[model samples]
Target: MEIVASVTNASKQYKTGDTVITALQPTTCEFKKNELTLIIGPSGSGKTTLLSLLGCVIFPTRGEVTICNQRIDGLKQKELANVRLKNIGFVFQSFNLLAPLNALENVMQPLLLLGISSKEAKQRAEEALRKVNMENRMLNLPKMLSGGQQQRVAIARALVTNPSLMLCDEPTAALDIKSVAVVMEELKVLSTTGKSVAVVTHDLRLKQFADRIIYVNNGVASENPTEEELFH
Candidate 1:
């Protein structure tokens, strides 16, 4: 498989007045094209830290990060923002949809922000909603929908950007079993489109759908873990 993004000897550290904390250990890893990869670990084990670095949201303190073979760790803030807008889509755990907007409106916001016309944004947003089986809920407000429904809308919003990489953080943490299954299956389908899908999840129930499992612990990254290591 082709590598969509990679970190080479990358690590992150935070410095206080007199103390330094290592959020992630030096490690090299690749996120492959058209694959569903899970980064699993206990809380505070640097799973999200690695995601942020790979997504170009935060630069690594040491080493290099590349997406599609372009080095990004040394990029300026403006350049980084451009890269993220063009290549990365984020799905937050909180389902951060605006309460005032209906489902279609929520999904179109990002496209509009990217300077797409209202008509075109609406068209693309509608198609994205259809992908997640959410077209019927396009007119419903967040308060009127179930948690699963809201998450589907969030997924539609992420897809509207046509991003090469989807960085999902705790996507199923608050979802019920039924909802988790629906969302995971939907996510699995997305991986067939030649995009890179990386999920940071604590839910072991979703591991069966992953093509690769990356275990993060105490700022370390272990790739291709056995099923036993992932679930137990």
Candidate 2:
């Protein structure tokens, strides 16, 4: 398993009137390719902050992050954005789909922005939606779909580009058990097909999907050897 993403002594801090809050302490970690890893911790423990750093959404206040062998800290903002758009896929807790666009159009947006021809973009989008078994719902708007269906559409949008890394933040937060299982099953299939998936979640119920588990506490991380606990 080659290292796909690495964080070396990373930290994020913020300053208020008279005090400085350290949102992340100096932390080091690495994620390998073709594995599903879980970032589990209580609220405010920096799980999301770490994901942002790894995803290149924000630079660290200190230390370095490397993605696909490129040092993100050295890149300019524009360069970083390009790298993020091309190499990373993000699944937000809110199911960030455009309400007005149908499922196929929403999935096609990324390819279109990358300058792919409209015809090619639609072709790829249809293939992605089909991967998640949502081809039948291709023309449904976000509001017309159930929560689980909407989330599957969002997943297809993220996977359409076949990104090197997939970052999912609380992906199953509000879903019922059945819907949660549906999403987790799809993610499991994704990881098996060779894309690296990292999930930031508090829902232990989904832990079984993780090939590796890293528990974050007070901005630090430690390996969870009891990953089998997920199945038990």
Candidate 3:
């Protein structure tokens, strides 16, 4: 019912030498609250470009991006980073956790960067790990955990900030089949907690868990596509 993010006629272009490559065509869409949305496409289909634009990793060449009622496309680097820190959470294909740090410390890192006190960050990190069912492994280093556990820690790190939007890029790509299933289940549970979740993945196995699917093709996006349409 709530609109967590919206892109109004957004498009992205990159200029290399004399060539201008358009990554995404003008598009408008809304990512709703408490829903798990998937942006699916093959390599070079603009899925990553679109995700980058939506996640505030990159701005559009034209149009607007509004997240939690704030326009992000035009924000200065620091301002954009602040908006992303406060409103958006990102998870990547790789777990991206430091090998030396334990799960709790990894989750606490962002909170500390946000100026949250050490004690408070620890408390918040513990709570976040619990949410992802990783409380039992909070003290374990990344090397000691399985791939799924590491991914869950990565997710907890994202959630610890209490951001309204969570963006993931091919989060399950590096996992085994069973780990992928577990991670997908955890992501589904996270979506139910009022956060807007959008993942850009080319993995068809995870498509069954999505509430809505956005198909990107040749730099254009089509929403609510059928599985048959996307797989072929």
- lDDT of each residue in 156-208, candidate 3, tens digit only: 99999999999999999989999999989888988999999998898877888
For model 1, the stretches where C-alpha displacement exceeds 4 angstroms are none
lDDT of 1 by residue, 77-166 (tens): 998988888888888889999999999999999999899999999999999999999989899999999888899899989889998898
Query: Candidate 2 residues 1-232, lDDT tens each?
Result: 8888999999998789989988889988898888899998878988999999999988999999999999999899999999998988899888999999999999999999899999999999999999989999999999999888888899999998889889999999967889899988998889877788999998777677989888887777777736553333
Cα lDDT of candidate 2 equals 0.89
| Candidate of highest lDDT | 3
Better of 2 and 3 by TM-score: 3
Model 1, residue 40: what's the lDDT? 93
lDDT of 3 at 60: 93
Best prediction by TM-score:
3
lDDT values for all models: 0.91, 0.89, 0.92
| Candidate 2, RMSD to the unseen true structure | 2.3
The true-versus-predicted C-alpha distance at residue 102 of model 1, in Å, is 0.9
Error of 2 at 159 (Å): 0.8
